[model samples]
Target: MRQALVVRGGWDGHQPVEATDLFLPFLKDHDFEVRVTDSPSVYADPAVMGGVDLILQCMTMSTITAEEVAGLVAAVEAGTGLAGWHGGICDAYRASADYLQLVGGQFAAHASRYAPGERSGEQADNYVPHRIEITAGDHEITRGIADFELETEQYWVLTDDYNEVLATTTTATRSWGAWQRPVTCPAVWTRQWGAGRVFVATPGHRVEVLQDLNVRTIVERGLLWAAR
Candidate 1:
């Protein structure tokens, strides 16, 4: 059986614990023995991550020690799969340049507005009807998932050139703001790091958002596809 370590708890707004809970059963269903921890123990012990097959991290906007970052990068380079959604993986450790490099993208901010008067400067609680266009239809992560609409926050990312973009969405148009030159952004992508895999989706802002059938299916498929 494959082993997976889930380290959660950084920002409650992303519902790290709750969002992780939604996906835990799926990993187990695939015959992975999942272990959930909060102390960052796996970071300290190289042996603890030695045989782990996958890592489902839900931590957001926090600082991870250098040792922790090295351990994670080493684990993945040694063949463990790494995957997560929203800020849990990409935007989690802002201060750690190495972490951002490994993930291939960093959450810059939530841009554009969902509707009139709905634009809050906040990344959380901003909801809108965004379409996730299937960019690379031949990729395994998005193979069967067609172009679909998601009513969630459209994330803007600062990315590296390596992502195999599978899906994207246009930035919401605003009437008040008049600086536009055709806005489009990556909503889902997969990248390879060493022998490991990294899958990212930008639509999952709230637990309720993922409840949408298409959203759930996209993320669920992403999880399985990202696993080694």
Candidate 2:
């Protein structure tokens, strides 16, 4: 049986526990013996990380110790799969450049809904409809998945060229923001870090977002694909 470590906890606004809970059964059903924790300290334990095949994390905008970050990167470099979505993985550990490099992207901001003549600059104001375009048809994680749309937080992620971008979303020109040109960002991507694989999706801001047929499909497949 494969082993998976689920590390969750951070900004409660992201509902780390609730979000990670959505996939526990799926992991168990797939023959993975899963362990759950609300801390990143486990990554510092070589013995624990060495035995794990995958790490499914959901902690957003939290800090990880230098030791923890190093261990986590080493584990992935040694072939442990790393996977998560939205602010969980990408928006975390902003102080750690190494972790950002491992994930291949950083969460910048979400464009506000910009409804003309309405209150803006808040969470509800930022929740808007966006399209996720699958750019790589041949990739195993995205194969057969068509483009989909959702009314949620569309992440404006800063990504590097090293990522194998399987999906992308284009941002719209907003009247409230200074930027006039529409921006295109990677919504889903995979990175090969040494012997391990890393998968990420920017769509999962809420439980319902994760439950989206296409979003769930790709995320589940991404979890399975990232296992060592």
Candidate 3:
């Protein structure tokens, strides 16, 4: 069986442990030998990560040691798939530009308003209901998934050219704030690194939200699509 390593723990607000747990059985059922660890030791030893097929990161908004970051980059470059949600991969390792570049996007600001007709960050509500627009219909990751609605935070991310966008969400203008800009956010996206694949979803802030069928399907498909 192919191995999948999960290093989960960072900001408690993202519920890293709980969120990572949601995918353990799913991966195991798919024949991946899943190993869950707290320390980033696997990232340090290339030998440990060498034969691994996938890495699922639940760490959010945390700093990573240079060696840890390097090990992950090396592993992915060696063709191990990397995948995560929310801020785990994107907002993590704030000081490491290398990490952000490897992930293909960075979480800039949360509540700040963006410019008009530009892709800018917006204030998103967790309880707000919104629709996820399927942008790339032919992608395997979103093959069966259609436009869906859910109650989650609409992610306003600054994307890089590497992302093969599969879906997006329309940014609504808020009169409560003084921003006069219309922005569209990427809700789900996939990117390639070396021979490996990376997939990200921005809606999974709360554990309960991941229980939604649409959300679960998107993430579920992402896991399989991202795996080597």
Candidate 4:
């Protein structure tokens, strides 16, 4: 059986725990021997990481030690697939450029309405409705998936040319006024890192956002496609 590691824990606002809860069962049902951890320290253990076929990480904006980052990178370079969504993967380990380079992008900002210190009811009001368009419809990760709409954070990411962009979302002018002149950005992308594959999606800030049928399907397929 394939071994999968899911490391969760970061900014609570991203709901890393809840997000992992939504997908762990799916991984298990797919015949993976899944291991769960809330700490990044596990990445430092070469013995542990060497056995992992897939690393499904959900750490957002957290710090990772040099040893941990090196072990994780080496494992992926040796053919262990790495996958995740939202800030958890793409926006994690802000201090580590090596991590961002491996992931192929970093979260620069989000198109949100809620300003600092502003609260709308219980929610912070960072969501904006947007459309996700399939760019590489023939790719395994996005095959048969059509353009879909969702109300979520439209991530403005700093990406590299190495990504095989499968889907994208455009920023609405209404959301950012002059700043949002329909700037199209990659919503889903895959990349090759040494012998491993890296998969990422930017629409999964909240559980409900990921619960979108199309979104869930794309993510599920991405995980499988990235796995070794």
lDDT of each: 0.80, 0.94, 0.80, 0.88
Off by over 4 Å in 1: 39-41, 112-125, 176-178
Query: Model 2 reaches what TM-score against the true structure?
Result: 0.97
Which residue pairs clash in candidate 3?
none
- Clashing pairs for predicted structure model 1, backbone only: none
Number of the candidate with higher TM-score, 3 or 4? 4
Residue ranges of candidate 4 with Cα displaced over 4 Å: 114-124, 174-180
| lDDT for residue 224 in candidate 3, whole number 0-100 | 85
Query: lDDT per residue, candidate 1, 113-201, as tens digits?
Result: 44547656675445656778998888777778789876667787888678888888877556654546547778888888898888788
- Candidate 3's error at 44, in angstroms? 1.5
lDDT for residue 133 in candidate 4, whole number 0-100: 92
Global CA lDDT computed for model 4: 0.88
Error of 2 at 128 (Å): 1.0
Question: TM-scores for all candidates?
Answer: 0.90, 0.97, 0.89, 0.93
lDDT of 1 at 26: 84
TM-score quality measure for candidate 4? 0.93
Error of 4 at 116 (Å): 8.6
Q: For residues 151-204, could you state the per-residue lDDT of candidate 3 as single tens digits?
A: 656667878877888898866766654558857878788888998888888878
Candidate 2: RMSD to truth = 1.3
Give model 4's clash tally.
0
Q: Pick the candidate with the highest TM-score.
A: 2
